[model samples]
Target: MTQSMNHEETFENPIIPGFYPDPSICRVGEDYYLVTSTFHYFPGVPIFHSKDLVNWRQIGHVLDRPSQLNLDGTPSSRGIYAPTIRYHQGVFYMITTFVESKKGARRNFYVTAENPAGPWSDPNWLEDAPGIDPSLFFDDDGRVYMTANRVPPSGREYPKHMEIWLQELDIEKKQLIGPKYSLWDGALKQIHAQEAPHLYKIEGQYYLMIAEGGTGFTHSVTIARSESITGPYENCKMNPILTHRHLGRDYPITSVGHADIVQTQNGEWWIVCLATRPYGGEYRNLGRESFLVPFRWENGWPVVNPGKGIVEMTTKRPHLKSFPWPTRPACDHFDTPQLDMAWNFIRTPRDHFWSLTERPGHLRLRLKPERMTEICNPSFVGRRQQHMTFAARTMMVFDPQNEWETAGLVLLQDHDFQYRMESALHESKNIIRLIKREHGEEEVIATQEIAGQRLYLKVEAAGQDYHFYYARHAEEWQVLAEYMDGRLLSTDVAGGFVGAYIGLFASSQGHDSLNVADFDWFEYIGVPQQ
Candidate 1:
């Protein structure tokens, strides 16, 4: 194991964890770039960079513009989904689906930039976009093409209804300019929900890669190839090119899909995809995160996990060893124009969701008004949950002498499965309490009075459960609760595409301008003790 203290027994913790899903990767020179699906999260499609695919750092977001990311009343997990990121020439492009509401008001959107972190252009709608998971490929013949999954109107069965379609793309026109052709649908039958088409060209043939099966435990990565970009593409003799299901239900990684391939400067290939690790094989509180797999060509075709046709948790083959892996960024002072790749939102946030100016080196989050039926959008910022049993601690001063003023750390799981352990005014004294909303019911488990100008709060998400612990006046840390089931608060059950997110939040229960919380620092320690 990369870290000895991590008992789950994987090579290492997630490179990028906690809600980072549908990852796509690209390599330019010695630097590697990655982007992931940001459904309903503002600053959509976060761009990350690394020298080694394992140690990634957030560069910036691609859809920071309002035109590119529309969060005006868009439901949680309804805006963007399954983004495919690719780079060509001096430009980087990513495409995703914008599902406005349950009524099925959805469309395809694209954004580009000369640099990953940049002045990304506004969203360009594919005028003929009908389905979802669109990806672009630049061929050797100086042609650009697009491929995606569409539910054919004529499909009859549950499995055959969805299939991949391809068309010629006019970059200058920003749209498809050729006829649509059907590509391989997995397993001939059981592979129904095949989508997220990413294409690559090797030698004289074209390879189409996609994430098939549902994005659940049954998720998989599949590939097919065509001598021509539009012709009949043949499936890989050993399909489901990469997966973890064979590892059985007790394995570490789960729900692997939405992958992107990158070649090292030395000409070696690797794929970065999203995977989740459930604490108890049922609850994935850390959400879907990015992972890496090495690849090579066999008999003129890419063999992801040769012989077995699935990805392994560990491998002996080393990456081409060209450039050094990028250093993971931590102990951030929050002085930059953007938050680190670690941060995530429970839902699409408004303009005032966060800011660094108010606290300078520290992040200042303003609680937005909450819908009773929706997850509350308050001042929140958090690092990805990489370790299954790590601890997140923060020190904050919550003043205002009002019971309505609340500020503390949280083990957040969408709107349904969330636990708030907060510091609030209790009579004339400050009180720290642990409260949880389980199965649509709010319950308080512990409360204590503390005397201090600032309070320290800590939350531990380990082993499929969430535990709250806090200390006042430098006293011994007390465990507030243990084994709080969080899977109950998921989009799968609560209705969204997002997963459980653990972070810090501050908000006022009443309309008062004086209520404020000043946090000193937030830290997440992994199994390696870093």
Candidate 2:
């Protein structure tokens, strides 16, 4: 699908792939920083840096500390959502919402950092912020404004009747003040889910861009303009500046929306949006990813993707210099003192369950009583499954004393839906088994008796078909399971907003154990698309 007339001039879609969604970008001087939501995953809102817009490198996470975010009982896809990153004067601000569904609450907050890489301040919760997808707009007069999506004051006339609201934000006090004004009700009022509001001042007019028609197949980006920041805005005649809904279901890219615009130092404009790539018929296991598109100002309104009119699978790269960073290796040896930024814990770990220096060159996880079936923090660390054709392997050594102890790899969608391959003592026999947990039903699909405790577990995916294999040593390999339903890890079947994650896990069922599972090395490699 990547048709490059001049090969070096074009860059592919999804500059940053996998489950990164609700992308927002802001450029300060020559450096550009972007952020995306990380729902239910610890160390939320990963920040990426880029110079040319075609290549990016992840600097760190905005919420890296356990004190910055609390996801103790938050369910998958319901925790953090729609982070917006903006820089003002000398500080960078990242604002987002934390949905504590167990408490039926949505708390909006912003954190500031002098350097975007580390030491982000703790949450500065807004008292009057009453909605999700909150964004900040800094005006020329040194005044700050906040906008978010909330229910219409008059309530719903149709389904999902949400409206964007704007109010003055006293940045010094860390709260919203003054009168709140209800802004545009979206381009198509009948098609709801109006959210992801971002206010921009372009050509001396206040322009508001938002995502409408939900975040599914009908997702889109719409624009409106107002002479005043707190006034009645007029929708663009050609609204829905970007979308792929009309391209039918078979299109490679769909559900394109929730965008944020950035103007480079050279005066070129670009957009970063969230879109899904469904390889296997309406099933997007990789979740909504960060996509880049060309943008321009036409007459009085903004245009997306220019001549193409839709977010293409491949398009022209930005006009900036082609800057590329040093390549990263596909394998992690667990020799570093700290975990890599790519790895994440499920929820907050109240107790220390993982270590790196304990065994010097291995990631050791103590087998805890909590299981992946529950909402508690089991001994698990996961990363996004970034490719459709990828193979991941890990070498681990563990001893299962009883049937209650288990350790292995887990392809997780959520607590209710997962595929677990573990080395456990089944009937007092050392067995490597594959268990399928779908829609709350647990069933053992396959089991193979293996020798010794040193194991090599691997999983491979070719399009929608997934295969699981294991070995007693590095070279001797055998298939444990094949042709399993990979759609079980998709949002369509799992009913979550997040993507599938491959994780390392250890569990003791309900019994307390002092044993640990040590992973010496882990590697993931993806094949280039043909």
Task: Judging by TM-score against the true structure, name the best candidate.
Answer: 2
Off by over 4 Å in 1: 1-15, 317-319, 322-338, 346-355, 359-361, 371-376, 426-429, 474-476, 486-496, 510-514, 528-530
Candidate 1 TM-score over all chains jointly: 0.88
Q: Give the TM-score of candidate 2.
A: 0.98
Residues 381-479 of candidate 2: C-alpha lDDT, one tens digit per residue: 999998889999999999999999999999988999999999999888999999999999999999999879899999999988999999997878899
* lDDT values, one for every candidate: 0.71, 0.91
Candidate 1 lDDT over 421-456, as tens digits, reads 888777877788888777678888888877776777
Each candidate structure's count of clashing pairs? 2, 0
Clash-forming residue pairs, model 2: none
Per-candidate TM-scores read 0.88, 0.98
